[model samples]
Target: MTTPASHLMTSLRSGNATAPRLTWYGPDSERVELSGRVLDNWVAKTSNLLQDELDAAPGMRLKLDLPAHWKSMVWALAAWQVGLETVLDGADADFLVTAATDPVEGRYDAVIAVALPALAMRWPGTLPAGWVDYAAEVRSHGDVFMAHAEPDPAACAIRAGGGGVHSQAGLLEGFALPHEDGARIHLAAGDGLEGALAGALGAWQRDGSVVLTAPEVELTDHLLATERIHGN
Candidate 1:
């Protein structure tokens, strides 16, 4: 099978346009739903920024030290599309994508910070020198990305350390969580990137939507029913 990142694009191209692909529930009851087409637009713009602006290419390492917000998924998909090895908090990387709340002192060639709050639009304060505001700059990039070259599935796509490397193919191999098509998988933000990856990839590969939640928010039956959730 093709990588989930690739399959996701195929799904979008094949007319999975208006369906909710990801629904994020943030702290303070913030909610956002992105359809496949909208999600693709974000990914494409992000990919364009990564490739065109940052000079990202195959074999470069891009660290994602972001929270389990919807934008994190966009960054991940964009990195994968460019064939950058996406790692979790791996200090040694060509690029580091994180939230504005994270420490900005790093040696990365490029730093992209995202503001996780809903409706925040842009980073509130002046960022450290050389850091890019994702929300602000991403909008300027084109909505379509044409990679200079094809990604190699056998190459490392994600590295969480522990002497293991998840290739593009491996990461795409859904985390084995059970759910039917269109199931809304709920994940807690406190679960972090690893937890989000497990649930998101699994649900996404199975033609299901994900509902990421903040730990503080209660997942009531009403919320589940209202969100059309099928799993947690």
Candidate 2:
């Protein structure tokens, strides 16, 4: 039915397939690049885990309480693919996903902890009861995900920052994306999740990629020129 995920999948397959879909730079000068297919693979595995194992379906609410890292972005797309609402807080959620060690403060149906480091393969410490390690469990799921029902784009997709809601269709509607010139977007302020989301969606819509920097990574002219980055 041409949901955002279906449309994005089509673009991923038919567009400039060789270009990088996302690139992440860490505070320690670590770099990671993901092609469209590779990004789709992550999304698929995440979707399978949320849908098949967790029994998450349409109308479910999931709290994305993690940082604005690559995995968090992947989980957002995965939740949208399975028609789950991605909320910023744990209020009225079926699941709360975070990178923090202590999530006992929140009451949720379940908790999933993600280890955010690039090389860290698993959660560092012991997880609380009923909590799942996203990295450890997600890899065991199939690489391809098939949704049981098509997502309604008009349905509420994200709830962020003190009661703001955005639908899947609205997220893309009137989105003015730059040309698909393989531009590398440099984000300066990493505070707003909604803004980051809009930028990512715009980049993907135009077959461009994003260069995300954490708060600690300083943006410099030399770094930008060396990276051949277009703009922020």
Candidate 3:
């Protein structure tokens, strides 16, 4: 079956691949932009890591404990591409991805620590024992993803906290926020990871772009004009 992840990736890599697909504004005057091709590469590499290194497969659950950052978005896409169910409600999961400096051990089969900085090559400080360093490890993975096992469309895709569950095939239909085609949408980090992911899915599905602002970063008029934002 053509899983939602595979379909979405195909769309992302098609036509005008150099167009900016995701742009992020963060604290300390940080700005990161990723074109469609680049975004797809990141997602593919992360998916490879999940599938090859962590042995992630369909029907398994992976909890994303990070905030609404670009890296978090990549993780979500990677998990889905690997056919792992994304758990947003802090539910018990087979794997855990977090930015926490000292994540509790043995709770999950594997733990991945993510660094929020766009240019970070590795975790700033000493990495917790038994934890995978995303920045340090992801680059070694393949840039193209080929699923070893097909995903079940009828399986649960997202376990949204208090928002209920969505099947793999119905994830985008259920959670994607409506937007105009090719629109540049702005997202606030305060909306949480779930909201950001949903908004991103909505925008990308429409061949649009997303501009996400961190909590401390104000969405100024200059930013809106520069990013050519058409909707929120």
| Candidate number achieving the greatest lDDT relative to the actual structure | 3
Put the candidates in lDDT order, highest first: 3, 1, 2
For each candidate in turn, the TM-score is: 0.90, 0.90, 0.97
Encode model 3's per-residue lDDT on 1-232: one tens digit a residue.
9777778887888788999999999999999999988999999999999999999999999999899999899999888888889988757999999998764744799999998999999999997788899999999999999999998999989977676788889878887778888989999998999999999999899889999999999888988888899964
lDDT of 2 by residue, 1-232 (tens): 6477557765765567767777777768877777888888888899999988888888788888877778787898888888888887647788888888763675777788988887777899898777888988989998788888777888888865656677766655533234445567875436655566667877787667787777888888987886677844
lDDT of 1 at 60: 90
Off by over 4 Å in 1: 1-3, 101-106, 161-163, 174-178
Write the residue-wise lDDT of candidate 1 on 1-232 in tens digits: 3455777666864566888888887777788989888888989999999999999988799888887779988898898888888888645888988875567565878988888886877798998777888878888999888888778878888765366667876676633355676677788888787668767777777778888887788889999889877764
Error of 3 at 84 (Å): 0.8
TM-score of 2: 0.90
How large is the C-alpha RMSD of every model relative to the true structure? 2.3, 2.3, 1.2
Quality of model 1 by C-alpha lDDT: 0.79
Higher-ranked by lDDT: 2 or 3: 3
Give the C-alpha miss distance for residue 124 in model 2, angstroms.
0.5
> What is the number of residue pairs that collide in model 2?
0
